[model samples]
Target: MGSKLGAAVAAVVLALPLLVGAGVAGIGSALFGGSGTSSLNCTPDGTTTGTVPGMTAEQMINAATIVAVGKQMGVPEPGWVVAIAAALQESKLRNLHYGDRDSLGLFQQRPSMGWGSPQQITTPTYAATKFFEHLTATPNWQTMSVNDAAQTVQGSGFPHAYAQHEDKARAVVAAVSGVRCQPTMAGTGDCNNIQAPNPAAMTAINYACGQRGLPYVWGGNGPLNGDAGFDCSGLTKAAYDAAGISLPRTAHTQYNAGPRVPDGSLLPGDLVFYGPPSKIRHVGLYLGNGKMLNAPTFGQPVQIDNYRYPGDDYAGATRPAEHHR
Candidate 1:
């Protein structure tokens, strides 16, 4: 699992898109609804009940493609839920043209990672078909939770993230296919149930907490750089660096630098970022208890502060893998 996840990380550099980033634009008729590549009897008379409210037309179109592809492939309804959940986590139901490394399309699958060519993956039908192919190939995917099934194919660092979108995935699938599925899938429940970080993650956070009294420097030296104090990204950079992980320099880049962690499923050593996905400016290491350790601006010393300070931008959080970058 670790080796596959490491390979996934190395292969898909910016593959982890922001969970709440600005929506991608300009999906025409081809990718939307069904492309009619294969015959499926899932033509909806109208928008089904339980469709996700506030979903963009692009999201609905991608959802339709996912369901259509699954049906044409003879994948079960549960498989539809798994596919929807994985797409939700990977590309937010958009057939994107760009992703980390060579990743492209709805699942952010990388040609370099052996999924398919850029042309094939960028097409909604092709992308969803490829995803279902890998998914059904997994043993007992029907019995697995959405997360387990998705993680088996995605190999994302945050394997538990797929479960977080189960309800919405179920809704999206139900809406598109007109098959109402219960929110809970077979494998597991909410990812927030994961209470404690593993020992390695604990070690990384503790190392950062130990540096609480260090002074804040703009681009000052981190422990990795062997400097006196830390900057925002530098603090997290130093902590994960101690854990033998390499991270990007800025807050925005660092946001997409590692595995995509859902909002409430954050672990101890996770890096939290501020601002919307389009404009991530600040960052910190979560210390639990609604507090994070960060270096705030020039002249402010490194210390523990409220995770959400008044007027804080509050973007999202990401967790680094336990292995070397």
Candidate 2:
């Protein structure tokens, strides 16, 4: 991850896109809702009945893709609800080609279930659909616990486990519902670059980037950067912290801190940088459109700049592997 960041930051002299999408033009996230903030107010369906707990990067992508595939295949809400719970329990939404004694896919489906070839069963969408199909064939699955409904389709070693993940599954379904999965630069980038981030997310990125042009001083991030201002690394840390993430002190240390974001996979508010040895040098919050907000140097107001510009140096970038606590 450090090496990758170094390579990206070293090439700060490229030309990036001049356009700004404002992201409001795309899907939008609603943050809070329900009678008492119980609703996630999802970026997709508008009202999330449950919540997706913070997960690993792998978990996030798998959950997102699977939900997207479900909706794409016209699988109904109950089917999705059941599938979500099953996957949440089975592998924490992680895609695994091998399962205990050949039980595989989201529902731990078996070849005996007429699920599909091994290849298809491993595919998130195909596997989820097959599980739902069996669920529909069972009697009274709609009213059953997510686990009970899933067990009807898959007789697993631990039948009750799925119940524990129901709320988590619902959260994923709501977040990824209807809205298509966009490829991420991380293994999750829109596989075909067909997706864009939600609008509130865009605004969040803008909020982070709009902070650029601010003076960079040692320890100057104020509430985050410290009272003195900020060093190159301090500036980056400050922006992300304001966006709801606390980070390590140095740029070099920050580089290896969390999930590695692949080139072009960066989202707004993503931490990007420049420097050697895979360490963080200068830091900025990505605002998409090939732009980001950076403090840069002394006496400069944190300002948004184009990643493709020749003057700004960039190393690599990172976003929260999952949601921040």
Candidate 3:
């Protein structure tokens, strides 16, 4: 870890041309839409440059993990933009086992402030998950500007620093995920829906949204049927059922029913899982842009939330076949 961290620092210490042929600089414009003003771009081989150059392979790998974990947690691409930007600013994408005042890992999360223990905070995946969980919980996070959203989560002494890294972060996410970061509603107070590619997916997402504000009841099946409310899996099952797809009762079984969607490739109406491996205990329907339709535990009503709650584990995801139907 120390040597890898050193390699990252040494590589970044040099200057590289921001404009690489058909890589980060070229492809990035297409993914983000060519306003012809943005400086982001990516190489076909996946090396990225623009905002900050000399990104090492190890750093890129960590950036990819952060994006993937955010997706697994139901974080939208914008959320990923903020996360990567912050990581670049805080640690330069290096998962340092050390930092000022007990700060550690990719985001420089602090243990003294209750971020987590040194071990948990230092683990790149765990640190990124913790960061996104806090970020998504911030009110109107999806609507806040990249810097504002990052500051809301990190509360860094240097609040303005994150802005400098957004372009590079977007570039990194593009290179690593094989998906370009799209335009976001950040800072605009419009967490608007991303259009579903097909009718069945649209229908299922709409059905789930229609049930918002309903109470959560354990083992409760459906509001349309006889049952009063719904549990986590119950809500997902019922929503898909309305879209004409059949799903098993338990979260684990439902997870096994469909082709798995990689976290970075999630589409609207996909099933998002939470818990441990095949033992997944909860499920929700992905609604694109980092939110999900959930029937949370006892006291909470059916609503949209950042897919992974604090301390809520991310299992995996599956895309229902109905979406293609």
- Sliding window of 10 residues with minimal summed lDDT for model 1: 17-26
Model 3 lDDT per residue over 65-146, tens place: 6765565455788998999999999999999998888999999999899777787677665677678778877889888889
Better of 1 and 3 by TM-score: 3
Q: Global CA lDDT of candidate 3, please?
A: 0.68
Pairs with steric clashes in candidate 3: 23-42, 23-43, 24-41, 24-42, 24-43, 25-41, 25-42, 76-290, 143-187, 144-187
lDDT of 2: 0.54
User: Candidate 1 deviates by what RMSD?
Assistant: 18.7
- Candidates' C-alpha lDDT: 0.65, 0.54, 0.68
Worst 10 residues of 2 by lDDT: 32-41
Residue-pair clashes per candidate: 3, 39, 10
TM-score of each: 0.43, 0.43, 0.44
- Scored against the true structure, residue 125 in model 1 reaches a CA lDDT of 66
lDDT of 2 by residue, 1-325 (tens): 1233222321210111111111112112211111111111113334322223475545655555555444434456877878877787777677787787777765566666566667666656456556655676788777887879978777777878778877777777664453433322211111122122333333345344444445666656554424545566666665555546667877778777856777756655467778764545666656555665566676776666665667645677776423441
lDDT, candidate 3, residue 284?
86
Q: Is candidate 2 or candidate 3 better by TM-score?
A: 3
**Model 1, 156-252: lDDT tens per residue?**
9788999999998887776566422111101111122211233344445656767767888878756557787888888887777777778888888
Candidate 3 or 2, higher lDDT: 3
